[model samples]
Target: MKILVIRRDNIGDLVLTTPLFRALRQRFPEARIDAFVNSYNAPVLAGHPDVDQVHEYTKGKHRKGFSPGWLERLGQMWRLRKEHYDHVVIATPGVHPRQIRFARFLNPAHITAFVPPGWKMFGVDQPVEYLGKDRHHLLMTYRILLPFGIEGDPPAPRIAFTPPAHSPGEAPVIAIHVSARKPSSRWPEERYAELMRALHERHGARFRLFWAPGAENDARHPGDDGRAARILASAAGLPVEAVATNELEGLIAGIAACDAIVCSDGGAMHLAAAMGKPVVCFFGESEAHLWHPWDVPHRLLQPESHDVADVTVDEALAAFDALRQEANAA
Candidate 1:
């Protein structure tokens, strides 16, 4: 069978859908599994053992209200028609009437999608209200697609990427992601520095810092921490390398390279968790139970009160210390 899965969203959302890819391949060993994803996340599917093809869409640019150009949409429709897919599944939310209309235009044997609380899943779900909570969106989406006759289990979010592997002989490593795009999401840099200091005292030179590439522009621009590089330099006390270049594949590889990750609650944290890498994620303005790493040796540090900043360096350090102990025990 030929199958097409659409998950044109962010890096984190794409990572969450990989488990579904694996499950689909396992069930239909002879099937072709293709994904339509945002351009930024297209690379994440690189070297995935299960996927046969990947199509990229420029939705981020299209969202700014520029002409996506009718020809581009026409080209996609033509490609889908030519591929002759037997099944099509849209894992992304906000499935428009037009999207469903187009899928029906192709005459796929099955089409599955998820609709929010008040919305209807016209062809499937028989138009049930989606009352599930947040973060469970990934699971809910997978469940919705299953009834369309796609054979697969609810997959634990796992990403596949080939990185320069480490020898088992190396000392235990600690991975850290010290920056985030949004200020409200970023933990104070000094807090990171202090945590690094504490970690160095405990692990010495064994720790490594992995940074999201392209973040340098955010750090170097005049308004964005003109001295951010130097600040991170002083704080981390170790050379930070750009492992993930704002692409899904690189992000997955970078996370896979690490034994554990200390990150703010963002795409990287989600990627790390999906890889089954132990994670210590700091949170703000989000619930830990909803977003924290699942089924992993993990800890979530969210603010006690209304202010997310209330989670101090001390609390974060304490969490790190606990992770370290777990590592040693393992």
Candidate 2:
């Protein structure tokens, strides 16, 4: 049997779909599993052991509504028509009519999608209701893949990549991803710097400070802050280094090799959690119950409001200290 899992969204969305990949692989060890992912987030699944192929779907590249874009869509659809898939799973949360049409275009044996109760549709059966009251988004999506006999615990999504070549005896490190793709989710830089200072003072030679790829450009706080760099210098005990490449896969491998990570509620924290590393993550304004890292000794500091800066520096430090204790115990 062959399967194609389609999730076309941002990094976090792609990350959430990884457990489905693993589940399918476990159930059909010999079957080929392909992931249809957005081009920007393709690297997250590049080296995943459970995935046999990575199919790129460029957003807006083939989207034309009866205009000049129609031809491009025709070409892309023609390419998709060539692949014979035994099953096609649409894992993206938001329902798009075009996705159903695309699945039909694949001419698969069957397609499974989520449709809320009272939702009526044509040519689609077995509507899977949104799993209510289950907060974690990744876990919720994993359930949709269950009917195909891909059962059991959906392990947290993980990425596998080669760590960048490091100089000999590089110090133990704590990666800090201080930015979020959404501006409203960022924690204050002053607080982050203070936590770095505390970690440096406490751990001394054991801890190095590092910034994640794309953080410098992901979200910008007003005043053109150099807080991430400053914190690494004064609070981090060792000179900072960039990953060999800015690719998300390389970033995950680098984080996996770290002693721990301190980050806001973003893709990096999810990666760390999936790697089973100790993580201290801040959450504010976003839904913590839904997006928080899973099954790891993680500390979540949430703000009362949407502004992540509202989560005080001391609160985050307390979580960090707790995570350290947990890591030591483990």
Candidate 3:
């Protein structure tokens, strides 16, 4: 069977859907399992044993500096249509009408997706009634494959990347990501500076600071250069090196090379989980249970006030200490 799984969303969302590809490959070993993803998240699947190929497209807004010709896009669409996939799984949660229409044009023998109660999602051969809460759970995306007789606590996410070499007695490297896509999730850089001092003193840890690149004032993709600068300045004497990741793949490689990660709940946290690294994550505004790192050793601190800023530096230190203890015990 030829199958295509479509997941066009944020980096974390695409990572969450990775388990499905593994399940598909296991169920039909001979089948061609390809992915239909956006350019932003396509690198996540690089070298995935289960994924035979990736069909990537950039959204109109994402085509700022690099836009593939319309003829190229048309040719890609035509080739997909010619493939005549036996099954196509809409790997997103809601009934996206535009994507639904797009999937219909592919002329797959069967299409499966989650449709809300009242909405009749045309062309979806198998519509799983979407439970509102399912979207929030990290592994709940697996429900999309139930109709195909695949069921399990979807396996941990996997990303293929070579990690940097590590020595025996050197201090463990920790990836510190300063990403605040949502305003409420922003944590002060001073607190991060304090935490870095404590971590280095207490655990003898080195740091690789990762963050959204580009100017914070960039209209299209506003990032955290200003915040990262402040955090670096505060840690002048510490072993905190800024990791310049110009591409999504570079970020993945950096995380995979680290021993652990400390960051606010976001794509970075999810990527760390995928690489099987321990994590100390902060949850604010975002639901803790929904987006928490899955199947990995993690401590998610979401204060009752529901703000990351409200979380203390002492709390972060304690969490890291605990993870280290767990490792030593193991």
Candidate 4:
């Protein structure tokens, strides 16, 4: 049997979907599993062992209404139709009409999607209801496959990536990712520098900064490189090294090398979790309960005012300390 898992969303969402692929592979060991993902997030699934193929849907200049991109999308759909997939699973939060239409276009023998309460949709072979209360997003993705008799504890997100060459002997390396597409989710630069200084003094930890280019397009302040420069300047004479990666694959490799990570609620945090590294995350606009690092030793610091900037340096330090303690205990 062949299966197609559709999760054309952000990097973090795709990361959370890894376990579903594993569960499917475990249940049907011989089945071929293909993933349809957004081009930007394709790297997250590039080397996943459970996935047989990774198909990318690029939304570029042709993405506007009635453009050349629609033809490309249609052409891709035509190719997918020829695959004769046995099942197609839409692994997203809610029932997206566009995705639903795409699922129908594939004409798979079985169509399964996550639907919300009171949602009535036609053509879905199995409609899984999303449990929003006290459920992690990773488990939510696994719920979609429950009808297929995939029972047992869901696997955590896993990635197979070569770690970049970096060594900090006898000193723990903490990675700091200072970029968030949402301005409200970014903690202040001064606070980040202060936290770095505090961690360095307390644990003699080495700091490695990770940032993606073009991050300033959506950020309120400067992008990742700019933020890294500012933090280094503010906390002068500190053992902080700025690591810049042009691609998601490079960022994943860098994060895989870290002992722990301090990041906002975004793709970097999710990447760290997939690497099985402890994390201390700052949450502002995003829901901490649903999006926090999954099944990893971690601490979350959220601002009372719902702005990441309101999360103080001391609070972040405390969370980092707790994360260190948890990591040590484990």
- For lDDT, the strongest prediction is 3
| Candidate 1, position 309, lDDT | 62
Global Cα lDDT for candidate 1: 0.67
- Candidate 3 whole-model C-alpha lDDT, 0 to 1: 0.87
Local accuracy of candidate 3 as per-residue lDDT tens digits, 5-66:
99999999988888999888888999999999989889999899999999998878778665
Indicate whether candidate 2 or candidate 3 has the larger TM-score: 3
lDDT tens string, model 4, 1-330? Answer: 999999988889999999988888888999999999988899998878999999898867314466677688789999999999999999887658778888998899988887777675776878888766457787777788877987678888987876545554577889999878777888888887788889999999888887766545554334566676777799788898878887788888888878889998999999899888888888888878789999888888887887888888888888888878877787
What is candidate 2's CA lDDT for residue 159?
75
TM-score of every candidate: 0.82, 0.83, 0.95, 0.90
Clashing pairs in 2: 285-306
Comparison by TM-score, 2 against 4, better one:
4
Query: How do these models rank on lDDT, best leading?
Result: 3, 4, 2, 1
Task: Report the Cα lDDT for residue 116, model 4.
Answer: 74
Q: Candidate 1 vs candidate 3: which has greater lDDT?
A: 3
Segments of candidate 2 deviating more than 4 angstroms: 61-73, 118-120, 131-133, 162-171, 205-239, 242-245
Whole-model lDDT per candidate: 0.67, 0.70, 0.87, 0.84
